[model samples]
Target: MSLINRLSTRSDDFLATLRKLLAFDASQDESIERTSADILKDIQARGDDALLEYTRRFDQVEAASVAALEIPRGEWLAALEALPGEQRQALDSAASRVRGYHERQRSETWTYTEADGTVLGQKISPLDRVGLYVPGGKAAYPSSVLMNAIPAKVAGVAEVIMVTPTPKGTRNPIVLAAAAIAGVDRVWTIGGAQAIGALAYGTASIAAVDKIVGPGNAYVAAAKRRVFGTVGIDMIAGPSEILVICDGSTPADWIAMDLFSQAEHDELAQAILLCPDAAYLDEVEAAIARLLPAMPRADIIRASLSRRGALILVRDLNEACAMANEIAPEHLEISTEDAGKWAEKIRHAGAIFMGRYSSEALGDYCAGPNHVLPTSRTARFSSPLGVYDFQKRSSLIQVSQAGAQTLGRIASTLAHGEGLQAHAASAQYRIKPD
Candidate 1:
């Protein structure tokens, strides 16, 4: 049996089959949701005491107080200094590139005076503080620490408080090193839904943050979802996805590994290819089979490919682009000779990797764009995480006396038409002194 599903646009049920392939049941684990809700409630009510209790139970860390869970700034700095020379150099370079890219994304306040001396514009300012949740233990992601915290800092957020689970109280030094490199304000040895609750509701030790951004387990995701109204949250991302639109010009082996890049994320992650060449698809499949044996994550890649991955044969390049726009993949790679031409037709991808040399893995690490992309088909409506995610906008309106004379009458008429008597009266009061 072939390891991956094969489909062609010539089939009568192609659209239907494509839709099925794209479908992901985001059904929340009710057990996890209920558990998360209970934890969040307990944290909100008990604050520090509940946090300490959960920390001990879940993370196996017995802290005398919630404050003790904090990994001091000096520790993060020491971790950075203690890293191997090559590792430190690479970390610094990636951080510099990410910071440089995000700096360009910074939004500034602006206003313009109208002919009537009235001023209207928008004021842009960063959130005061942001909570960054880093998954720790064996699943520690130092790159996540850089991706989440760096953008917040670039947006001018005053503080970035990091919370990571330390199983058996064993801290991941690389994760701590990332915190220092990203300029995170504080580091706390905490995790799970309780951490989300503390960041959302505020504990004596854990100061509430304006927003929270990071990936987490089911409990953490649920807590972030429930506490969304209280504090802003980056989207609850679904499984990662990568869609390659190839013209068969790129190396078959390169394309095969590109598919594995996203597939290795988890069993649920999707990796698909849309090409007009069937022979090339066969070649890529053969490459995948030959390369599978040597991959460290071969099992995960195989399971993912068997379950959701697809080798799709489109009618032509135009049709492939159309299908790509419909799929709206988190990562879209156009590995063709004129990749830029196809990229111009693409409207919906979280990130587009143009040309054969531009691999998706680079974007995940040091490509200078955010790796925190919209997963599943959410790229259709959402975007990659960036500096804008940490900034809030406020409208600025300044009415001159003369301008108010004209605006008040308009406001009064609109308010009266809506039967808001108090609103109309207030507007009329401004229009007429009496």
Candidate 2:
């Protein structure tokens, strides 16, 4: 409905406001530990039976067998043909851009030869298999398919699997078409914790995967957290968030529309604006008032704005940057002059959109960057899911007789310092004698 005031709070008061803005219920327990434990036990104990039961109960669909789970190859092809030419062309272009961008992120194996001829390097290779979890049912976002799968494909992963819920016992053709464009190896009609379990443990129908990725509901997030140790996960994503910084140069209508983009996601989603002048804040607020009632999800956006969104009036752009760093939102837009100059001051954020033309939605769809980003201030430590998520690195070291003698003594000393006798002996043996 309106931008909540965050400027009145003291710096110490900021944390509490931030927690409220982030929709963090200090009293609320996530129940991830409990839910994941049960899901894991059921999948481990009964495998396909457990998965099928959960799928029926939660998803309201019967996937009787693994063969029935996969979207047929012919159907996938047909889905592409079924789409309007414009839509198909869009997917193609987006896929190509995503692929080209991710291709640059591909890690390469590198080795260095020491003066003593000791070769040391890191081997970068894609995982044998990867599982992508795309949230379906309420919405169909072909962009998500492109965002999640292209990175793995670029990383040279052997297999890229996809799982989405089909509530009507049918898949969206656009989803299938996008999957084809992104080079998906398999697509399954399973979702929620059960889909995660299927990917982690490998049921009769779903193969075990090295990693699982994509955005989902709380159950899905909990499921990913549950399966983390057994397999790698992208990140435990929180609700959507956006932070826009402007110096009154951009139109208030455009700014308000951008803020609404994130607010419409969910009531818990945050849409904040950090500006130097109160007049700019007023203009944006007026724009929001004019625009909110027209949108389909106005109620959701209004709730989000009232509960979590903010319009902070700072003294200068520097102060705005400081506040933004404090928030560390999932999406940060620099709509000010010299957008690149302000970007350098941003120490925390999931993704930074610079300049007037660079909209957050572009990054969500066609931009080269992955849209799956860390939220709820986790961006301070985490990052967007990318080529690295689908790959593993192993250190490689080779030592000659002389090199061994030089390094082994140091290794033995370190082992001894740490009270590891066997470790010391193992290093000592190579250089101690013939």
Candidate 3:
């Protein structure tokens, strides 16, 4: 049986069907929310004691004190050295690429002097500290360590603390190695809502961070959501999503594997292909059937494709570009001749992979761009994680006595219109009497 849905723009209910397929429920689980809230409160109240207890309960790692869970900086370096030469080289190369890319994204402080001697500008500064949460054990993601940490470091963050669970006291050396390469300042063996609480609220052992980032389980997501006001979060991302616009020129096998790349992430991950060529869609379907059995994560890919994946036939490449804008996928691949031409038509997408050779997997790993992207159509208003996410901007205003006279009237007028008497008076006080 064919596992993926096949549709065409000619269908009467095509738009409605597309909307239903694109729908993703981003609501937090009520049970997880309640549990995360309690955990956050417990950590806030009891601090280290509560953290240790939860770590023992959830991760099955017993520690006498929260300090015992802290992984030394030397250990991170040791992990980097212990890796096989090829793995170490890969990690170093990826780190160099990520750092190089983000170095360009660093926003510099700028000022402009107006004719009236008023100095107005913007000052950019990195966060004082940031928390990175890496999933541990079997779900280790070294690439995520580079994606989240390198940007903070490049933005000149004073400290970057990392938290990862060590289930049954097991640690993944690759993750530690990545942390070292990415310049993570500290690592704590903690996970779930408790770890988020420690990062947000701070304890005797763990210091509070200005922001927390990286992906985690449902409980972790809920915890991040609840603690957002206390600290900045990257984004409450939904399941991974990829939209591929093919122009019938790329190989069917390549397209099939590109879809599999994200579908294998989880069962809810959406993988959609929009093309004008129905015959090419059929070829890709054949490739999926032929290739599915060999993949180790075939079950996950199958479930994800069957549940949320689609192969939609559009009128032409223009229509495909229009549809892609509507989806605003986390990762978008344009597999076509002159992919850049079609890419120019795209308005919304977290990241765009151009040309037939540019695969989404490359962006997830060695590519310089951040892999932590906006999901669930959030690309419409949001953006990919970058150095900017770890940096804060402050408006600089230095008004001369002469300039204040002109500016104060404008400010007082707006403040009074809003019925803010105090605000109006504060601005009025700056106005010079004629």
Q: Choose 1 or 3, whichever is better by TM-score.
A: 1
Provide TM-scores for the models. 0.98, 0.94, 0.97
Reference-based lDDT, each prediction: 0.93, 0.86, 0.94
Q: Give the 10-residue window scoring lowest on summed lDDT in candidate 1.
A: 425-434
> What does candidate 3's lDDT look like per residue over 1-434, in tens digits?
46999999999999899989888888777899999999999999999999999998999999999888999888888988999999899889989998999999999999999999999999998999999999998887999999999999999999999999999999999999999999989999999999999999999989999999999999999999999999999999999999999989899999999999999999999999999999999999999999999999999999999999999999999999989898999999999999999999999999999999999999999989999999998999999999999889999999998898888898899998999989989888988788
How should the candidates be ordered by lDDT, best one leading? 3, 1, 2
**Candidate 3 global TM-score:** 0.97
**lDDT tens digits, residue span 1-434, model 2:** 33455553336676676666666652324586578668878887888888888778877888666677778778878899899999999889889998988888888999999988899999998999999998788679889999988899889889999999988685788998899888998898888887888899998767799998888877777778778899999887777899999998899999999999999999888898888878888898899989999999999999988898888777789988988898888999999899999999999999999998888989988887889999878999999888988889999999977898989999999999999999989888899575
lDDT of 3 at 61: 98
lDDT (tens digit, per residue) of candidate 1 on 332-376: 999888888989999999999999999999998888999999977
TM-score, cand. 2 vs. native? 0.94
The parts of candidate 2 lying over 4 Å away from their true place are 1-3, 6-19, 26-36, 432-434
Pairs of colliding residues, candidate 2: none
Model 3 whole-model lDDT (C-alpha atoms):
0.94
